[model samples]
Target: MGTNTRRALTVAAWIVVVAIGVMLSIQRFRDAVGSDIGTDLRTFVAAAEHIRNGRSPYTEFGYVYSPLVAWLLLPFPDFDAAVGPWTAASIAALWGAVAAVTATFWRALSWWQRPVLAGVGIVTALYSALLSLDLWLGQTDTFLPLVAALAVFFASRNRQIASGVSLAFGAIIKSWPVGLGLWMFRRGVQQRGRLIAATVGTGAAFLLLALVIHGPQMFSEWIDRTLVLSEQDLVAYSVWGAGRHLFTQSAALEPLFVAPIVGTIVSWTLAAFIVALIVITLRRPGDDALSMWNIATAVVLLIPVCHLWYFVLALPLLWTWVAHALKGTRRLESLIAVAVMAVWWVIVFRLPPLDNQFGESTPQYIAVVGSSLVALTLSVVLSARRDADRAVVVREAVPA
Candidate 1:
């Protein structure tokens, strides 16, 4: 494609993405108001109200979030009035994240690649099923993923403290971004020491503040609620969760008679294994960018709940990879990777063919499990190879 033609096509694609986003937003808004059912934003507002009224959110409505989240919401004028505005605000903030990440990619590209690649990358990311689900559900996980993205962007620019603080804030709100922090630790001994100190110090301060505001009992209650929630029936869209649904639904697997809770156990086991793998990869030096992308992917894949919104954590990483592919010889491989991912995400998260209960159909199950496994394996291999290549370059640079 000619440069001008590609740029024009990318622009047209972005227009389509925007139109789709607007349509989804209108439908979601109608659903939110008409159904009288509360989304996560409403839950968050209710929890904030409890905190404002000097009650425990955990005791009131089983709010699983850390106390810091409730405290953060205290400044909102009225809890009931805050939901729509906060949802809108989150959407706006998510756009900012898209811009930040796009700019990050632009910075890494040649001038000729910037306009076309930026438009294509941002449009591809924003149009994903994961992001569409995120906006429609009023999921506050948007902010955390945005923070994690900003952390990577800052770290890439050598802003250690800023990066640490951003990742630490996300970790304080939600635990997934801790993986990003660990990836940054892979930079080197000196940088890791600085990053760890800043992250730990910031996180410790936040916890102490929460402890002072809400007593030790509140901490105990929060911990209990989180643990209880984790052990709930696995409705999660994660690898093992989807596999469990598939297995339970499969008539062929019926003879095996797998226990329902077995899936939950397996998901947690996989989560631990993924965590170990990422940590080990980070501990060894590699391309910092590659490490960040791999760590983000690993964290999202291993998260027990793995809600659709949570997958937004992978947006920056995915788009960056896409840009690299568009500019590289392996464009076909990247296209296949992305197309498979979009299909898996749509089936597993956006449009599950089966009901909440099990069913006869197993296509969604097979698609989700197969695509997830393939993507995860591909990510690990690519990251390891990039790291090895970087190591070879460093070795060759030194005097022989």
Candidate 2:
């Protein structure tokens, strides 16, 4: 067959795949409406309404997000009433936008890989339960990955302020992306001060604006609500948190019996480990893509509590590995990534009998967290071995 014909066939196949995925995704969105759809967005919209009424969202609505988020949604006053339908449409539009952006980046690839990459991205966005929940809840989690992507893309072009703004906005929405901001700063020692300044300045501007809208009292109420939520026995997708679930039958897993200090110690220990992973990855020679992947995976693993949608943070990292696979750089890693992502999709979407029927959550939590931890561990170990081998080669090459 001619190359042109083969390319045409590949594109046609991708079109079919994407068309099917979109139809299925829309059905899922339709099912989600009037049934716990846009729960988080509803909370935000409710908070906005509270704010508009000269009431504190933190006190009135138990809103955990920073006050700035409510203000951001002020333009959409009708969000509360129509969050479900609006979010469904938004999710579809965002997936299309993501596919188009991903395609632009892969323009150098062969025609087949371009559509395949785009089709894969679209399918994952549309079909995965993580993203389904993200859209259904009208969650900001979907937007964070885009923010991280833009940060990396802009940093690649040496657009420091734009990158900083993206990262800062993400961090303001949720604290985790501050790690990404710091990663960008570490990439350029000379640019370090300006990067930090820009990130901090951006965050502060929003925070101050929020405070002005509310009052000094809002800070205390926000902190109280945050602390209350933290103490809740939320089933998180972290190694430590999953351990809490897996061993719930055992007395050792009972937080009530354990000292509060013990819990705090475990949290800090995991955090330190994450910091080590970030440092190891940062010291290695690689492009911004690899750095973003390393930092994002580490951050996700270390988050104290994580929902299904929180895993979206790793999407860009997975995409980077997929790109490497397309280039035949590391097919093994890519295969592992594909396998892990498949397992994750199954766990999140619950594929019928694989459901978390019991509240214990061993099946789903272990599957998702275990697969991610294994992939991350392999990446770190391989990177260390590669660096060690290079060091030995350098030593042997020195004049004797």
lDDT of each: 0.62, 0.64
Give the residue spans of candidate 2 off by over 4 A. 1-21, 34-37, 75-80, 89-97, 100-104, 186-194, 248-272, 348-360, 381-400
Query: Please, what are the lDDT tens digits per residue for candidate 1 over residues 116-155?
Result: 5545444544445555445545566768657776776777
Error of 1 at 271 (Å): 5.5
Shift of residue 79 alpha carbon in model 1, Å = 6.2
* Candidate 1 segments exceeding 4 Å error: 1-36, 75-80, 128-133, 176-179, 187-190, 239-280, 283-286, 327-361
CA error at residue 255 for candidate 1, angstroms: 10
Worst 10 residues of 1 by lDDT: 247-256
